[model samples]
Target: QQQVKQSPQSLIVQKGGISIINCAYENTAFDYFPWYQQFPGKGPALLIAIRPDVSEKKEGRFTISFNKSAKQFSLHIMDSQPGDSATYFCAAPYNQGGKLIFGQGTELSVKP
Candidate 1:
């Protein structure tokens, strides 16, 4: 149950629109849920994250919603801009704390 399934493999949003991406997991051993944003040639950067204790977390235009009972979480991007176009990944570090189980990446494209 280490897999974190994500949806809307690809999305196209108009500039200034809201972009939402979702993910679900089955593992309960995970402690930290982090959403990462990756550009074409750079490593994924931490966009936002939440703990099981927190129901939701927000950073600027990026927000992450967590459902501990459902083993799910989602990322919301408000005022999506063309610069926000990138691949996003939802991940949780295993109990051992070295490896990360990731959801299928969501590719978002913000059209101008």
Candidate 2:
């Protein structure tokens, strides 16, 4: 199993709203999980992540809720804001090559 698929292609959330995006994977062997955030014309940056050994992980305004049994994971952005508008991506590596298999892309728009 080595595939991760994400949805919503795009999202729009109002300021102070909660923005949620879901992802599914096929690889059970994957041990590392990471969610990346990117701005226009920029490379993806690590936002948050969780390991298979853990159920969930949170960092600052970002959180990653993982389900090992369901082979699913999600990213949650708390108190959405206009500055939070950007593309989010979920990814996993095949075998620690520093290469990540990413979701198609999700363009998030946070309105003021």
Candidate 3:
């Protein structure tokens, strides 16, 4: 029931291209920013994340860019492939309420 606005709602990319998804939040209570990847008929899995202490972090072909001042973050997938196609959701965990607020989710399609 928290408000975390996610943009584009969906995305399409070709193999070996880059895929990017963005999300913004109004509540500054969020300390941890994480992106979850979900496939059809499966649960969401942790993909990449960043903390307020850093501006960006990269893992493999995945990267997370965080802006503390803007209360925003993004997930970038480099060299995207058909296997990378899935739904991505950005989350912000509120410590006080112990609830993880998730964005609307972005559906990514990587075509070969």
Residue-wise lDDT of candidate 3 within 19-85, one digit each (tens)?
Answer: 9898998784757888999999999999987877789999999999988778788899999999999
Give the Å error, residue 17, model 3.
0.8
lDDT of 1 at 47: 85
Model 2 Cα lDDT, one tens digit per residue, 31-110: 67788889989999888889877787888888889887788889999999899999999987766557778887789999
Residue range 1-112, candidate 1, lDDT tens digits: 5678998899999999999999988874656889999999999998888976779999999999988778778999999999999999998776675688888999999999
Q: What are the runs in model 3 whose C-alpha is more than 4 Å off?
A: none
TM-score, model 1 to reference: 0.93
Residue pairs clashing in model 3 are: none
lDDT of each: 0.89, 0.85, 0.89
Q: How big is the positional error of residue 51 in model 3, measured in Å on the Cα after superposition?
A: 1.3
Any idea what lDDT model 3 has? 0.89
